[model samples]
Target: MSNMQTLRFYVTPSHNCSYLPDQKAKTLFVDPQMRISTDSYSQLSELGFRRSGGHIYRPHCEGCNACQSIRIPVELFKPSKSQKRILNKNRDIQVIRKFPIMDHEYFDLYKSYIDQRHADGDMYPPTPEQFHQFLVEGSIDSWFYEFRDTDKKLIAVAVTDHLHQDMSALYTFYDPAEEHRSLGTFAILWQISEARRRGMNYLYLGYWVKACRKMNYKTAFRPLEMLIDGHWTHYRQE
Candidate 1:
C-alpha cells in the first residue's frame, strides 16, 4: 500500500470565505512536517489539493461544497471564439519560461496588479514578504511564464506548478494598465498549449464555483473536468 493513503491531514478552523461573501470556509491541509516528494505532490493534486506557498490544501467548508476542483484535458481543449481573439491580440507579447524568482521587477508587477485589480481582496497593500511567501517559497517544481511586450517590458506572469502528467495553473497577474490585452485568458490558453506541447495530460485549474462570478470564467475552457464526489466528470454549463 502506498503511503499516500496514510499521510497525515489536518483541517483548519472555519474562516471567512474568500470567494463567496458572508459564508464560512474550512481547509484541509496536509501535515506541514511531511516532506512531500514530487510524486506525492502529484498524488495530492490528483486528489484536488492545491499549493499556496508551501501549504497544500483543499476547500472543506461545512454545508458549502461550491468549490469544485477543475482541470482541462489538454488534448481535448478547444478554445472558444473569444479565447482565439485573446490569443491573436497577444501575439505581440512574448512568453518566456523561467524558474520562479524573488526580484523587484516581478514584485513590482505583482504589487501593481494587486493594488489596481484586487484592492478589495485580502492581498491588498501587497508586501514583499507576502509575495515571496505566496508564489516564490513553494517547494513544488514550479516555473513562471514571463509575458513581455514588444519593448521587453514585463506585462504579465503566470505562476505554474509542474506535476506528473499534469501542470497546475497556480496564479496569474498582469499590468492592470494592459486590460485591453486580456492577459489572464491568454495565460491559461498558453498554458494549455504549452502543456499539450510537452505531451502532458491535464492542466489543473484550482477550483470553480458556479455561484462566484470571479470563478465562473474557469468554465470557458471547453471539455473541462470537475472533481465531484471524488470523481472527475465532464462539466456541462447549463
Candidate 2:
C-alpha cells in the first residue's frame, strides 16, 4: 500500500449547502485519480473524510462547520429501547453481505427510495447510471447487506465499507412501504453488531448536522463520537 502521506488533496468550489438552506459549502477531497488503499481509506475516514462513489471528501466550508463526522465505538455502544424494538421488529428480515453490484433488484429499491423519500434532493429522478455510480462504482472495500423478508423479497440494502479496524455505513435504501419497520435504524443496529462480531472498533456514520431534522436519527445511537476541531469526542446531546 502506498503511503497516504503521498496522496494529493483538492478543494471543491463553494456550492449551495445541502444540509443548510441559504448557506454555501465546499469540500476537501483526495485526488480522484488515485486508487486509495484500504488502510489509507480507513485512515482518511478516521479524520472525518467520507466516500461518495469514487470520491473521498469532508466538509470544508469556509465559515460553516455544521457537518460533523460521527462514528460509534462498537464495544462501547449499547442499544436504546427504541433500537431494541427496531431489532425485534426486523427479526424476520434476513441480512446477507455480498460484494457491491449493479443488480436490478438493488437499483429498483434505490430508485423507489430516492424518488419518493428524497425527490426534493439532488438524487431525484433516479437513473441506473446514477445508482451504479453512487454506490457500486467505488473501488474501496465495500459490501451490500441485503435485507430480505420471510417471503424472500428484497426490502432494504445497506452499502458499507470495511475499513482497517472499523466499518463505514455508506448509504442505505429501503422499501418505502416498510417505513413502519424502521429498517434504516435496524440496518445500523445490525452493522454495529456485525462490526463487533468482526472485532472492529467503530462504525463510521458519514456526518451529522445538528440543525437538520433528517440527521436526527443519527443521534439515537448512544456513545457516539463526533469529530470536533480535529478531535473525536463523546457527543453530548443538548
Candidate 3:
C-alpha cells in the first residue's frame, strides 16, 4: 500500500461561485499538507482533484456543473512555428523549481501582475498575507517554478502540482513589465517541456472560457483536449 492510497477528505460549505454567475459552489478538498503519499496524490487527481495552492479540490456544488477538470495530452502536443518562436524568444530565461514560498518579492510580483492584468478583478491589490495564504497554505503536492533572466531578475512564477499521470497548473503571474516576452505563453510551453521530462502525459490547464479573452489564449496550445461531459475530447486547430 502506498501513502497516496489512504483515504482522507473534507467538504467545504457553499460559497459564492467564482465561475458562473448566480450559482453557488461547494468544493471537496484533500489537504496535501496532511500525511498523504505521492501515490495518493496521483489517485486523487484521476478522481478529479484539481490542485489549487496546496489543496486538491473537486466540484461538489449542488445541481451546478459548470466546473470541469481539464488536461492536455502531451503525446499529441506539437508546437506551431509561432510557439516555437516564442520559445526561442525566451531562450535566455531560466526555470527553477522550489517549494512554494511566500515572500516580499513574490507578493510584489503578484500585485504587479494583478494590477496590470486583472485590475478590476477580485484579487486586485491582494494583501501580502492573503497572497501567502492563497499560494502557500494548502494540502497537496505543489511547487513553484520561478523564471528569471541572466541577471536573476524574477520575471514570472507558476505554482503547480504533480499528479501520477499529469501536472496541474494552479496559478501563474509575471512581471508585466516584460510584455514583449509573452511570459504567459512561455510558462505554458515550459510546463509542457517539464511534463515531457517527467514522463507525464497530461498538463491540466484549468479552464478555457470561450467568452473571456483572457482565457481564449489557452486554446492556442495545439493538440489540447477539452473536458466535455467527463470525457476528454480532442480539439484540432484548422
Candidate 4:
C-alpha cells in the first residue's frame, strides 16, 4: 500500500477567467513543506499537481478539466529537425544548476521578459522579496537553472523541481533580446537532454492551452503525455 499523506484546501475562484472564456477557476494545493517526502511529492506530481511557490497545485474547478498536466518522455523525445536547428543556433550558451538565489541581474531579466511578453500578466514587476518567496521558500527538492553566454551574461533562467522519476519545469523566463533564437524552446530541449543524461524518464511541463499561442509551443515536443480523466495518456502526431 502507498503511504503518501495528502492535504486538501480550496482557493477562491479567480474573478477573471484567464484561460477559459466566462468560466470560474479554482484550484487545490498540496503543501510540500508539511511533512511530505520527496518520493511522495513526486507521486503528487504524477497526479497532476504543479509546483508553484512552495505548494503543489492541481485545478479543482466545479466543471472544468481544461488545465491539463503535460510531461515529456525523455527516452522517446526526438528533437524535430527544427528543434535541432534551434539547439545548434544557441550552442554558445551555457547552463548551470544551483540552489535559487536572489540577485539583481536575474530580477532584471525576469522583469524584462514579463514586461515584454506578459505586460498584463499578474507578475509584471515582482519585487526581489516576492521573487525569492516564489522560488526559494519551498521545503521540497527544488533548484534553479541559469543560462549564460560565453561572457557570462545571464540570458535565461528556469525554476525546476527534481522529482524521483522526472524533472518538473516549474517556471522559466528568458531575455526578450534573444527572441530570434527562441530561447524558450531551447530551454525545454536542454532540460530533456539533461534528464536523459541524469537517467530520468519524464519532463513535466505544466500545461498546454490551445487557445494560448504562447503556450501552444509546448506541443512541438514529440512523444508527450497529457493527463486526462485522472490518467496520463501518451500523445504523438505520428
Candidate 5:
C-alpha cells in the first residue's frame, strides 16, 4: 500500500495555532531523511497528512483534535448557489496549470497577497527564501495553476500536488484587492471541477477547524468527507 507503514515521523515543538487564537499546535511530520514517492505520498495523504513544501505533516496536538482533514469527493461534488455564482463571476479569468516553480510573477502575487491580507499573520514580511522553501520544495510531483485576468495579469496561484486518487491543495494565494471575485472559494470550485475533469476522485482541502471562523468556509462544499479518528466520514452540519 505504497510503503506507508514503514516510514517514520517526528513531532514538532508546540507553536501558536494558525487557526485558533491563543491555542498551541503540534504537528507530526514525516521523517526528513526519508525519500517519498508519489505512491507513498498518496498513501500518507490517506492518513490525514498534508504537504508543506519540503515536509509532510498533520496536526499532532496533545490535548486537542480540532483540526480535521477535509476533502471533496469530486464525482459527488455539487456546487452550491454561491459557488455557482463565483464560477460565473470568474469566467473571465484564465486558469493555466504549470510546474511548481518560483516564478517571479507568482512570487510577486504571493507577496502582495500576504502583505495586504495576512499582515497580521505569521507570513507577513514575506521573503524569497521562505517562498521557495514553503511552496516550491516538495517530495512528490506538484504544480501551480496560475489565474490571470483578461490583460494577462496574474490574480491567483494554487499550489497543488498530484497524488494517487486525489489532488491535494498545498496552498493558494490571490490578489487581496480582488475580494469581489471571491477567489478563495472559486479556487476550491475550480479545483474540484478540474480534479473531476482529470479523472481524480477527491480534492483534499486540508484541515477544517470547527471553532475557527477562518475554516468555516470549508464546510460549504456539500458531501465533504472529514478524517476523524482515522476514519473518513461525511460531515453533516448540525
Candidate 6:
C-alpha cells in the first residue's frame, strides 16, 4: 500500500503551546496501531516529525509556524569559538553510552534537574514512571549516554535514538548547579562528535522555536539545517 493508504494520523485538540506563551497548539500524531518501525520513523523525521516516548509527533498548530525541526549535518558542522571553549572546559568529563536502563541515580539527577531548571514546565516534578516511559520503553534503538565528572559523579544524561543513517537527540538533563561548566551545550557537541565517529549522516536536534530563548542554543551549531515547508535548507546566521 502507498503512504496515503497505510498511514493513519490524528490531530490533537488545541492545548497551551509549550514552546510559546499565550498561544494554543495542536499536534499531528501517528496512530500507535501502525506500529511504526525505525525505518518509518526515519522517513517521518525527514518530514519534520519527532518521537516522544512511544509516539511520533509534529507540531500541527494552526496559525503558527514557530516550531521548526532542526538537524546537524554531522560532517559539515564546525564548532564556533564558544563551542570550542565548551569542549575544552568539559575535557575532564567522561562520556559513556549504554542501552537505556532505569537506575535510582539517574532518576535522582533527573529530579534535581527538573526542580532547578524546569520548574515551570510540564515535567516540573519528574517521576520514575514518566522517566521510564519517556526515555526507556520507547524503542530498541534508544540509548542513554551518561556524563560523569572526573570523580565519577554522574552529571548529565542525554537520551538518544539510533537510526539507519543518523541519530536523534531525544532529551538532555544535567546538574543545574554546574552552570559555568555548560554541560547542556557540551552534551550536544559530544553527540555530534559521536555521530561523526559512528559514520552517521545527521544528528537530529529536535524542534527549535526561534522566539524561545531556551531553544536558541540549537542554532549555535553552524551549517545547520531546518525542515521548512517540506524542504531541508541549510542555514547560518551572519
Per-prediction TM-score: 0.96, 0.98, 0.85, 0.92, 0.95, 0.95
lDDT of each: 0.91, 0.93, 0.80, 0.82, 0.89, 0.89
Tens digit of lDDT per residue, candidate 4, span 1-238? 1236455545756655567667777877664446667787788888888777767677887766777889999999999999999999999999998888788888888888888998877776677887877777774778779999999999999888898878988888999998998899999999999999999999999977666666888888988899889888986554
Model 1: residue 41 alpha-carbon error in angstroms = 1.0
Whole-model lDDT for model 4 versus the true structure? 0.82
Model 3 earns a TM-score of 0.85
Displacement of the residue 89 alpha carbon in candidate 6, Å: 1.0
Better candidate by lDDT, 4 or 5: 5
Q: By lDDT, who's the top model here?
A: 2
Q: Which scores greater on lDDT, model 1 or model 4? A: 1
Q: For model 1, how does the per-residue alpha-carbon lDDT over 1-238 read when each residue is reduced to its tens digit?
A: 2258667899998899998889999999988777777888898899899999878899988787899999999999998899999999989988898898889999999999999989999988899999998998865689989999999999999999999899999999999999999888999999999999999999999988888888878988999999998999999889
* Candidate 5: worst-modelled 10 consecutive residues by lDDT: 1-10
TM-score of 6: 0.95
Candidate ranking under TM-score, highest first, comes to 2, 1, 5, 6, 4, 3
Q: Report the error of model 3 at residue 120, Å.
A: 2.4
Instruction: Write one digit per residue (lDDT tens) for candidate 5, span 126-218.
Output: 998889989988637788899999999899998889897889987899999899999999998999988999999999999898897878988
Q: Native-vs-model 5 lDDT? A: 0.89
- After superposing candidate 3 on the true structure, give the runs of residues whose Cα lies further than 4 Å from its correct spot: 1-13, 31-34, 236-238
Query: Which candidate wins on TM-score?
Result: 2
For candidate 4, the per-residue lDDT at 185 reads 92
As a whole number from 0 to 100, the lDDT of residue 165 in candidate 6 is 97
Task: Work out candidate 3's RMSD over C-alphas.
Answer: 2.8
